[model samples]
Target: MSPTFPARRRGKARVGAALGVSATLLAAFGTAGSAQATSATVRHGVFPTVSGAAQIRANAVGQASSDETLSYGGGIDGIGVMSGQPKVYLVFYGSQWGTQTTDANGNLKFSNDAKGGAPVAQMMFKGIGTGSEAWSGTMTQYCDGPLVSTGATSCPSGAAHVPYPTGGVLAGVWYDNSAKSPRAASGHQLGAEALKAAHHFGNTTPASNRYAYYVILSPHNTNPDHYQNAYCAWHDYNGDTTLTGGAVASDVGDFAFSNQPYNMDSGAGCGVNFLNSGSAGTLDGWTITLGHEYSETITDQNPAGGWTNNIAGSPYQGQENADECAWLKGVTGGVGNVTMGNGTYTEQGSWSNDTDQCALTHSTVS
Candidate 1:
């Protein structure tokens, strides 16, 4: 994601900016008890060694007029819902953005910020990862593959399709407005498109996930500059204030089960270009931003939704940069704060169920 620089003080890395290996936990079976979960699910791992954890004490990331740092400095921390297996959003057949919610105080609520002159509402849908991927549940290491970031479009020849653990259902769909097309209309329009795609799933689920995860793909952002879509502002506080897209690549199609944030303010799929130095086809930035955003949003809808504006301090567990890719190792073994292909600087932070691609001990709130 883009560094909220110029707004940076104290100078630490942005959350999930470094790149490296996944922390391996030793278990009786050689992995955490959650390893090789009994389900037919495939397993994906995350990278964390490339970056170091951040001090994350509110005053670090960005400052305010009153001398306070941004409360929600990006990354998964203090979310309201952090239970069971990790879950995300999937677009619905009849609507978009899923549903919006409120916080503990119930003062801050989710509202629709219009786009293209049309009005709308932003909601939180739930989703999960497919267990039986073509890689046989143990596939990691994605490179510059067209199918990699393309989702169902680039599902290679024999990619398997799996679902989230437990009651995980295809609750909604997400849109994939990559570099262009369906830009301003990303929000609701994207939701509508996803619903259309679900019709193609053809009898996948009758109990749940009966819909497909609709998505759209933009090769290059039509609004690379924040001139048009606020999604371009990514890191700016005002960024979220921009017109919310009614769509995303996730919406162009539908899956048996998909993923999205659990809460309304769930800021998934938006960030500065941090992968391969902002490569066009990398999921690093997408996954990292979406993972952390949804992770925290689902946990604490208000505070978790990046609502507090000053609630910093997300202790990261894994080692990945905002680019959303794995960090294997640098010559030095570990990195603190580093810039990516875009010349933007970011702080390093921990990981959690923020990402469903990997095996996270997904936690939820009461």
Candidate 2:
């Protein structure tokens, strides 16, 4: 995740760094600079993870390509993607996630979730907008309006896109055992527990959190902000002042969040078998790390404003759209098993500026 460097407008600068895979082995994931804000400007978007011999030496030296693809980092308060009807709440954070129940296909069960992973993350967010799911149709072709033009990688005719979650973006779920989560919980206490889950899901306002999102989750063996040494999840909004107990003000406008730890406790370096193996791939890094921070908080919700890879010196500058297909496996839109309507999980594959690449399904743009 952490790459985005340039910023002077919509609070951009996320510098946790280390993800171009090979500048001396990505300098062993080093780089950290963020924590100077007088009026707040630190947006952050990081989901980095690369061990296992740095992912086999970054797949034998052939993975540094980000010439110029994703764009449109123009809207902040006006928001960018998740243009409409995309919700996902799921809080769960604390009391070590014990005692909660409902199974029998009603979903949302707990009892310390040994690895059941909270009903497979509520049936993968109720099987993401059901059967015709083209993997959420590759983010309905990226968008934002007002005539789209701040780095615009594409998206013009009528703009305001990113829809497709027709009936499932799991708009609710909470546990908040309320006082056991912070084993490592920083990032402004996970943005103040996502503004206390937007006042416990009433969704305060800013039009009920403009296409909301707030997965804080974090229990089973805990580690919220350090995310088990670096990141297996990341996404921000409470106006990221380099979070770690900094930003997080929100009077109910800048929402969007994520920090979702508990990726089966980082096994297999955060993707358990990378794609499917014995035991049907134990949660496969919990739905590919929560569907890669839920498609980067519905297309850069409030970090870098929306959509990224501004190309300043391009090494996938501040990546987004599932960080340009993280953890690629088989090929052709990497990582597999997408199925959707209530089963077959293992996801990974996003970033498709009209088929420029990395698009496991795509074909819904509108």
**Most TM-score-accurate candidate:** 2
Clash counts per candidate, in order, are: 107, 3
Local error of candidate 2 at 221, Å?
A: 21
Computed on alpha carbons, the lDDT of every model, listed in order, comes to 0.24, 0.71
lDDT of 1 by residue, 1-366 (tens): 112311211111222223211122111112212312221111111111122111221212453222211222132222212222333333322223223344442211223311210111112111123322111111111111222231111123332212233333223333322222332333334334434444444323422222122223222223211112111111111112121331223322222121222211211223223333433323333344333333223222211122122212222211122212222123221112232222222222322222322322223211
Alpha carbon lDDT of residue 20, candidate 2? 30
Q: What is the lDDT of residue 309 in candidate 2?
A: 70
Q: How does residue 365 of candidate 2 score in lDDT?
A: 81
Highest lDDT: give the candidate number: 2
RMSD of each: 19.7, 19.9
